[model samples]
Target: MANIQDSAQQLEEAIRNSDEFQNLKQAYETVMADEVAKKMFEDFRNTQIELQEKQMQGQEITEEEIEKARKVVETVQQHDQISKLMEQEQNLNVLINDISKTITKPLEELYGAQEQ
Candidate 1:
């Protein structure tokens, strides 16, 4: 367990230095430096979080909110920098998910992976 913890820390450091993380970080900085893009991104994120929270809380979100969120998404997707940031985010997410699967492979083998 101690060895695994040490390896985990090393893996985390490696991931931070990885191309995916570096690209994501650079893309994020580019988006944040543009005030208009930054504001747009923030609005999109806030709207998404609000909707997700409402769903999690079992609250019925109105059609207006859904339409507004859709518009926000559409507008943000039009910005090049914001779109690059989103793409980098997805790239990083894929890397993280792949790593997760690799780390959990042993457990899955031991318990037999179930078909979802």
Candidate 2:
């Protein structure tokens, strides 16, 4: 019937104009969910990059510190060797002075005996 058709058309038009409807709600929710997913993925990617950079920097600093420690060890070893050599030279000088004193003592004793 013509009346039924007209009523149905009016009902369709009213549904299209109404904002408090069920049909658009699903679409809006899907759009908002997509935006949230995009933002989360971006944040995750940025955090991963930042972490990687920090790890790289830490590795470089560790390597530098290791190298510095090696140099310090080498310097200490060199100084230790130098100290040993200096001690050996001082011992040799003391030995030479003892020999000179022993040789001069006999000469002085003979000279005193001749004078007496």
Candidate 3:
């Protein structure tokens, strides 16, 4: 059991020191463009939902209705793009957390062992 724990800690340290993990952590932290994209997507998705609901409720739509729907479609496209970005962010977050735990677990174990 002690050997198993030590091996796991070494493996975690190795990944945290790896170039790929370091690069990903940097990129995820520095990227600000995703914020704008996410906001735009939310706005579009909300509009699409509202317009679709109104159309479904037998609201009398005129020429303005067509324009509104078209706008909603445009927003839907933007939302799709944003959703993709959000998915990427989610994936990166999970990856980062996993890697961080691996990197720090040894230190945590040491502290815990000392306290015991």
What clash pairs does model 3 have?
A: none
Assess each prediction's global lDDT (C-alpha) against the native: 0.95, 0.52, 0.65
Query: What's the best-to-worst order under lDDT?
Result: 1, 3, 2
lDDT of 3 by residue, 91-110 (tens): 65787788678769989999
Better of 2 and 3 by lDDT: 3
Q: List the residue pairs that clash in candidate 1.
A: none
Model 2 accuracy (lDDT, Cα): 0.52
Q: What is the TM-score (0 to 1) of candidate 2?
A: 0.26
What ranking emerges by TM-score with the best candidate at the front? 1, 3, 2
lDDT, candidate 2, 96-115, per-residue tens: 57656764797878888889
TM-score of each: 0.91, 0.26, 0.36
lDDT of 1: 0.95
Give the residue spans of candidate 2 off by over 4 A: 1-78, 110-116
| Per-residue lDDT of model 1, residues 16-112, tens digit only | 9999999999999999998999999999999999999999999999999999999999999999999999999999999999999999999998788
| lDDT of model 1, residue 68 | 100
Query: RMSD to native for every prediction?
Result: 2.4, 46.3, 13.1
